[model samples]
Target: MRLHRGGRLRWPTIGLAAVVGIGVLWHGRAAPALPTAEVKTGELVDFVELRGEVKAVKSVTLNAPSSTDGDLQIISILKNGTGVKTGENVVQLDTVKLQRTREQQQSDLKRAEAEIEGAQAQARLQEEQNRTELMQARYDVERARLDVQKQEILSAIEAGKTKLRLATAEQRAREAEQKLRSGRAAAAADIESKKQKRAKALFEVQRAQRGIESMTLKAPVDGMVTILPNWRGRFFGANAPEFKEGDRVWPGAPLVELPDLSAVRVAARVDEAERGQLSLGQTAVVRVDAVPDKEFTGTVSDISALAKIDFSTWPPPKNFDLALRVAQSDPRLRPGMSATARVAIDRVPGALLIPVAASFQKGGRTVSYVLRGARFEERTIEIARRNREQIAVARGLRAGEKVALRDPTEEASRR
Candidate 1:
């Protein structure tokens, strides 16, 4: 059926050659290569990796002094990272208002004292006047009695007059005695009331003085001062400012943090999936993101029982706060530094493990592809456990067995 070339009848031969070339082209296409891994027996470490921040194991938070009067205004604060000594002044609130209050209280106290003095003087003057009147009354009574005795020698009318005069004198003397007693009682009561007022004024003055002292916060322990975030009724975000002069801080608001540099730790949040994998006293390898070159060893010390949710977002993610005590302290490890912790939960001294990619789920069973004579054969394997990088095989696979990392059937389909 081919066209003839040159001489003779060559059509049949040309047709045969064309058929052979097509056969060769069909047989020469390359087969796709399948990537594989060899199962190995080695130490398998099951660890939970967490991203966290460096923190002080021991930290003292300095909160703004509790004030009955509104938010306290910061007047002076030690700069962040400043090393401080014990009892050193670290923060100071605006004492202008407190000082004014103290002054007023003192003035009130002075007034109270003056009132007390006036009350005492008035009492003394009353006592003297009462005494003089009482004496005059007694003298009059005695004169009246002497006149009455002389009346016995006079006429009956004179006697009667003298008797009336004596009776009036005696009545006047009794009235004077009553007035003196009443005056003393009134004076004592007045003086006591003034004393009570003075005591109250003194209390107010003392309270004001204590408030002034509270305005100046002193460092309880010696350490570097780190200013805390000023919430200021705003959402926490990157670039939040710290407490500074002129900032109004609410009562009990954290103004500064003095971190004990000698003791350090890492605080990390664990995902719900890894919650059961972490336990107290678990060893971990910690690496600071800022100081990557330096690695620290730590032990899990604490874990929150309740999950923390950020309500600001819808469908918030649950995070559990956990702390790991650093085995050794480093000068470069500072609070707020981002870090990563690889907590070793379970360890197998020797186990047959393979890359997770080497296994696939088939018929609800773990299966691997084993190469046999240039063909991949699907082999069912029992998986004991799986980690991030590898899976531990319990049965159906042996150490040193070569298996396809990816399904070879996919390669065949592509080819």
Candidate 2:
């Protein structure tokens, strides 16, 4: 029943209209539209991508081989980017001081030679004089012995004065013997001292020769000559420029570097999140940004067992570095070229896969929508494997099923 409007029997008419309106409202409410998806079988793959750099297989910063004794002067850079053969002179240090040292050493050596000669002559002369003196002393002793013998004979004849004279003669003979022994010993000591002086002089000469040879720097291997720069614009051998044209350098300064560029390998950093999927001998596709059209193929040659921390700044950033070997190297590929690398982690052969966005969670399991006539229905599906872009459907889905592509929020608004 309904309230009467302004005419006879309006109550019955109003009640009938009310019942019809309720029926229309109830029938017009449609089921909420649900998003749907289809099941399909396809291949899936997992990959880890990282930014890398193209580098020489062997590259090193040449350090001065000698210690920093003084300001090193670059005499001359033999060849820049010039291919030098092994044993070739890459750099020439200033040999002024070296030359002066050599001259001084030569002078010292000459002086030593003269001294040795003088010592030898003196030793020979002294030995001859000692021999003469020894002979003379022996002659004198013999004469004295004869005299003592004569005196003794006279003393034996019973003359008191003759006995005293014989005693004095015996004393004089003993003194001559002592003088001869002392002269011989002094001569032997002088010869030994002279020999030692000669040995010391010879050692100094050898040392000087070695120092001179060190001034000339030679290439250790056949490679390109890269002149390393010092704080000043001059490029010298490793360590510091220890010599000028005339400056003498001490031993062991790094003066040159010979780098072999037969092959190139890239040392790249891979994030820890992707480290688990990476392994040795995996194929890598590298693209050098400098040479965009050229693609280089490589394999994972090595992986760092431990993570490296960058302590240069506060709170270190951690990363796992790896080395990728270019199977085929091009001459144009140089060190420090920016590159991109793709490392394949896993691949599925002809498996059912779908866009990751199409899959949603329902009751702790992945689910998707399946279009049913004019509406959509939610169907729970099992995910065997997944990546950021796609997921492999394991079960609860079939091929040719249509799924909604609209945003879930839009679908809810429609409801």
Which is the leading candidate under TM-score? 1
lDDT of each model, Cα atoms only?
0.87, 0.66
Question: 361-401 in candidate 1: lDDT tens per residue?
Answer: 88798899887655677899998877888888989888888
lDDT of 2 by residue, 1-415 (tens): 5555576677678999999999887556553454445667787877778787766677543444363246445566564467787777766665566566667766766776676677667766766766665566566556655655665456555455455555655565556556556755765666566556656666766666665565557777677765432333234332332223433333454444455567877778876788888999998788888778788888899999999984434566688989988877776665656788887788887778777887777669777776665456677888889876778888866778776555443566765
Candidate 1 worst ten-residue window by lDDT: 231-240
TM-score of each: 0.76, 0.58
Question: What is the Å distance of residue 205 in model 1 from its true position?
Answer: 1.9
Candidate 2: where is the Cα deviation over 4 Å? 1-45, 51-63, 66-73, 78-80, 93-108, 145-212, 226-257, 271-277, 309-316, 351-415
